[model samples]
Target: MLQVLSSESAQEILSTLTSDPGTASEIANSVDQSVQNVSYHLDRLCEADLITPTKTWYSQKGREMTVYALATERLVVQFSDSTD
Candidate 1:
């Protein structure tokens, strides 16, 4: 997980999504990035199995929209204690 989070963009996206599940467009808004750019980063995260997208319906402008949620299972925390 640490290795996967090493990427700055990935880390930012993950952090935002972790706070609240959102679609590629929403994430792009939160990160102030282009949708295509955000999607590219999301694809990498998905490939690393660090994030999962779930399909769901959302009402926007009186229209049902499909969106996604980041799977909490993808997050892993490691603890280490050492004096260097």
Candidate 2:
């Protein structure tokens, strides 16, 4: 999870979602990135459980689009010493 969060693109995607849930294309536009790049980050974010596909919408061309939103409004991270 930390590894995923460490990415700058991932962080930007998360920030974009905070204001409004959107499809990969919309996120890419907001972050000034390519759709493929944003999609890759979105997949990682989904795997890390940081975001989720809230709904599905169809484009005018009959393409399926998934809207993503943050899984939680807030996140808290804590570190613990493994060696005791």
Candidate 3:
């Protein structure tokens, strides 16, 4: 997850998803990015198990929307203190 979050754009996207689930377009709008770019990052995020499809709904124009939310609410990392 740390590796995946290394990307600044990915971090922005993840922050939005954490607040609430939204479709790619919605995320793009919220993040002030192109839909295409947001969609690409969404795919990577899903692959990394950082987010998951939570619900499906329809747009005003009848387009289906898939919303994604954070897969893990919180993560903690602690490095070992061993001397080698």
Candidate 4:
């Protein structure tokens, strides 16, 4: 979980999923990345249970696609102000 989140690409993929669920192809387009790259991170997020397949999108060619959405509503990260 922490490992995946530490990745910039994974973070970008997660940000896109936060808005709504999408297939790897869709996310790749939105993030301006290759489908292969997006698909890889999606697998990581799924393994971490951070995202899940919520729906399906079928193409005109009859290919079924899995759509992923955020399993967790929010993620907060804060840094301590202490100089020590």
Candidate 5:
């Protein structure tokens, strides 16, 4: 999770989602990245539980598009002492 959060692309994606939930293409456009690149980061973000598919929409061509939003509004990280 930390590794995923450490990425600049991932951070940008998260930031983009804050204003609106969008499909991969929408996110890519907002971030000025390629769709493929955005999809890769979206997958990583999903695996990290940072984002989730909130709804599904269809394009005029009838292709299914998954809209993604942040799983949580805030994230808190804590480290435990090994000496316990």
Candidate 6:
């Protein structure tokens, strides 16, 4: 999961999920990205075990949609303080 966090898109996805679980469409809209692009990022996050999808019913459409959210609250960060 930490490895996936290295990617910029993955990081952005995680940040969005941290706020709330959302469908690929919702995420794309928020980030001003295409649905396919958001789906690709979501797949990587899912593969890394960083996010999970919840089966939800969209009342307005009366259809099921998968909402993705962060699997955990703890986010990992790596930094270097060395100056040479």
How do the predictions measure up, each by TM-score? 0.68, 0.94, 0.87, 0.86, 0.92, 0.77
Candidate 4 colliding pairs:
none
Query: How many clashes show up in model 5?
Result: 0
A best-first ranking of the candidates according to their TM-score comes to 2, 5, 3, 4, 6, 1
* Tens digits of lDDT, candidate 5, 1-84: 999989999999999999999999999999999999999999999999999999999999999999999999999999999997
- lDDT order of candidates, best first? 2, 5, 4, 3, 6, 1
| Superposition-based RMSD of candidate 3 using all C-alpha atoms, in angstroms | 1.7
Q: What's the lDDT for all of these models?
A: 0.75, 0.98, 0.89, 0.92, 0.97, 0.82
Q: How badly does each model clash, as a count of residue pairs?
A: 0, 0, 0, 0, 0, 0
Candidate 4 per-residue C-alpha lDDT over 1-84 given as tens digits, one digit per residue, 9 for 90 to 100: 789899999999989988889999999999999999999999999999899999888999999999999998987768788995
Winner on lDDT (2 vs 4): 2
Decide which is better by lDDT, 2 or 5: 2
lDDT of 1 by residue, 1-84 (tens): 566668888888988877777878789899899989888888888887777777765666665533545666465576777862
What would the TM-score be for candidate 5 when compared with the true structure? 0.92
Clashing pairs in 1: none
Which parts of model 2 have CA positions greater than 4 angstroms off?
81-84
- In Å, residue 34's CA in model 2 sits off its true spot by 0.4
For each candidate, C-alpha RMSD in Å? Answer: 4.4, 1.2, 1.7, 3.0, 1.2, 3.9
Cα lDDT tens digits, model 2, 1-84, are: 999999999999999999999999999999999999999999999999999999999999999999999999999998889985
Alpha-carbon lDDT of model 6? 0.82
Candidate 3, residue 75: how far the Cα is off, in Å:
1.8
